[model samples]
Target chain A: MAGDKMLFVIVIGCGRLGANLASGMSAAGHSVVAVDSRQSAFDALDSRFSGYKIEGDATEFAVLQQAKTVSADLVVAVTDNDNVNLMAAQIAATVFKVPRVVARIEDPRKEDIYRALGIETICPATLAGRAFMASLESTPPKGAHNA
Target chain B: MNVLIVGGGKVVYFLCRAFISKGYSLTIVNRDSAECAWLARRLKAVIVHGDGTDLQILEECGAERCDAILAVTGHDQDNLAICQQARIRFNVQRTLAMVNDPDNEEVFRKLGVSAAFSTTRIITSLIEQRTGFEDIINLVPLEEGKVNLTEVVLRDISPVAGRALSDIALPENSLIAIVTRNGSPIIPRGGTVLAAGDRLVVITLPENMGRVIKLLTGGR
Candidate 1:
């Protein structure tokens, strides 16, 4: 949507969120590198996904180096493990000095910590809770019927 | 002195006891609630039930005012984050992290952690000293293992056994500090003659250690 400007992005983990982001970003004409500890996880990426795939633990600094995080414009750490995501995000922010770093944290309590460290985080539980609450508060469209 | 320790396990339990005995005020941050309860009851310290890598939890534990922070979590990444946060955000004077992978030690050091200890490297070195090479025993490692104090035992068939210390070609920067033969110790001099069964206390760079060992043990 922001013209044809291509951005270098590194996505840690190959879970649903990571795979989707990598594929979606690549489709949008961005250079993307997706990393996962298990090679099998890369199977989730669709054939249209044009990003590079790296099989290694993101927690290890060498793996991040292999991903070429130093030149990355954005880093997304979406690993299922909170500590792994946090560490990856911190390395991207503090060590590599990536312009933008985001981590998916499952624990809402960790939001303050991420904020303190200046890391952007998305928590699915909080988002889902808010969405459910909004659904309860909003009335359905006149044409819509209860299933 | 106030100390903040992150993680709970056998190591943390022992450290808690040691710090308590040393009269240091202690606070522990751990994610496991059960472990937190156990630590709270067993140790004379405050236990916070949350991840140590979390800034809120760390702040609640008074990380900013702590004299030292020890991040000894079983997970290397968690330990790294905890130590980094302690140093960068809290500005703790001293931060120590336990690295499960020895290769991560340098990375941690470069990231500004005051100290990084790898149990794997320590155990590997200990085992190597006990069973490796047969002639060279590493006494101590200095300068992050760049230099070492080594003990080389001279064998009967060693090429330098009967040679004067000055005559034997040694690796650069290597110096034989003392030679103990039979039951007496002698400070090595240029004219000192090396003998079989003599134990040579040498200081050398780690890269040249093998060469020194081979020279003293007849290349065995």
Candidate 2:
């Protein structure tokens, strides 16, 4: 998202997706704070990632409080653990009243309940499953069938 | 009543026993295979080996029509997910959760769990109550404060301190469910005697709280 206004963003879980988003957003000039349980997870962030890094369990309220979630303009939960992501996202949305909160939920069945709670969810399984289904359409590009 | 309990641990066995004795049909959902096997051998409830947070597992355990769902998992997040999914997807009216973090009790309530209990808060309250007051040690609210549970210690000053439960006329809608005598809990029966130094766990309505406390502690 590009706008003239800069936003304070908190990314929970410094996994591959979390680190990439934190680095990208930081490079884009937004204030970013990346949180992870393991300090080594920060190694994945790009050196150009000028965002602040805090190592702790993002699912914990204390960690989010230390990350200044109360003033966060946006919070993203991309942890590998579905429950952790749900907890972090819900706390951001309900407890801290963050404006925008999104979570990566691997279980597609849980997406509806997450949305019902006023939080957005990205389910990798559903997204990837759709992509696989689209690939089976068997429509080749121009001249690709000849190859 | 049919109740679905998630998580297979020591609490599961004891809860199973308690509910079974009460004549309620039960089902247990657990993630650990070995624990599931052990629970299957030890308990009389249907065991489903899967993550309780998953909607499919709850559906497999017949959560849709169960009278209540209890999430006693060790993790607060998992417990919240289980209860939330049970309520949202299955439309289970009564859902209780064991909150691992004492602070998340309010959070769980706000998130739509029917009731949330925290052992840490209870134990902390007991310890603090021992140091804080002579009687009426701790108070906990449930069902959005529609009901209240209080821990009252019977002292020499108490009016009903030396009487049996059958002899005392307790306030309407209030009951002394458990009596903790010298650190052990005894479910108060008709013949159970209440003595000084016994801790009473009383469940009552919000309106009668003060009167119940006064009656128990003779503090009016």
Candidate 3:
């Protein structure tokens, strides 16, 4: 879908979401640079992933500098820790002037504040919670009601 | 005054004691259950057991009414998040955060943290000041680095070493605060003579720090 423009992408946190996005974007011919504190997290990237990996804390400016975040058109922060995602995303948005930045915040309540700071936020908790609630309404799970 | 402190450790314990002495109300939040119990038993402040960065935990701590919030977590990101949440969500008047990385001090301040101090910055500044210009005894960046408290040691190489304070042309907005000679502090005056080994504590703007040092040390 992002094929219209060849963009440079920086994905912080090489976890499941980060790996998948980096792999897919790289496969789509976008230049992808993935960063993670743990070197092992790079293993999650798809075999076709041609992006570069930088093992470092995304919250640090030096690491982002090493990742050449200044040239990034899009930055995605999906670390397990919401705080890390918030800090890293803010740096990419404000400091590096990335065109688009997204952060994964598990807490739905924090989405507004994150957005107010000019960073786009995705709440996995709220998304899953809504889907699970909808399924419960349709299936009428008796065991869940009793438990 | 009411203060809410996020994250618990020796810093929290000492902070609580200091605030208690000043008769300020205190609330401390920490994630570890054992640390919370320990802090609760020792300090007079209320100890909250939960992630300090969690907005719910901060709200439960009555952050909305807290006069100040201090986030001294080991992680810089967590501290920044806690301070951001306190300022944005709770609208806390004053939010202070401990930055683990010295570089994050400016970044945190840019991101809306009221005050971001780094022990690493202080230590590194001390080392750097001591290393360079061996004549500079100590250097402290005050008022968020806008003002500098610089202590310079006068030597024979200084042009104004033996001159009276009034005779030397001190830069504008800069003053010699104190002069210490032979382990004795002397309030500087127009008649005060600069000795070769005298320690002069000069207060100056960061931009004028170099000029002040150059004027005193007779360096280019």
Number of the top candidate by TM-score? Answer: 3
Question: Model 3 over residues A63-124: C-alpha lDDT tens digits?
Answer: 99999999999999999998899999988888889989999988888898898799998898
Error of 2 at A129 (Å): 3.1
Whichever of 2 and 3 has more DockQ, that candidate is 3
Clashing residue pairs, backbone N/CA/C < 3 A, model 3: none
> For candidate 2, lDDT tens digit of each residue in A1-147?
657679999999888999999999998889999999999999999987998899988756678889999999999999999999888888889889999999998888788989898999999899999998899776677798689
A-chain TM-score per prediction? 0.92, 0.91, 0.88
lDDT of 1: 0.87
- Residue-wise C-alpha lDDT for candidate 3, range B1-220, written one tens digit per residue: 9999887779878978998999999998889999999988888888888988888888899999999999998998999888888898999989899888878887887777778888987887778765655777547667766788988888899999889999998989999999989989999999998989888899999888899899999885
User: What DockQ does model 2 achieve?
Assistant: 0.45
- Return whichever of 1 and 3 wins on DockQ: 3
- lDDT string, candidate 2, B1-220, tens digits: 9999998679999999999999999999989999999999988889999989988888888999898999999998898889888888999999999886777777778777888888998788878776856566557786676888888888899998889889998889999989999889999899998999999989999898899889878985
Per-model TM-score on C-alpha atoms:
0.69, 0.77, 0.87
**Candidate 1 at B125: error in angstroms?**
1.0
Q: Score the docking of each candidate (DockQ).
A: 0.33, 0.45, 0.63
Docking class of 3: medium
Where in model 2 is the C-alpha error above 4 Å?
Answer: A141-147, B131-137, B146-220
Model 3 chain A: weakest 10-residue lDDT segment is A1-10
Q: In model 1, state the lDDT of residue B66.
A: 98
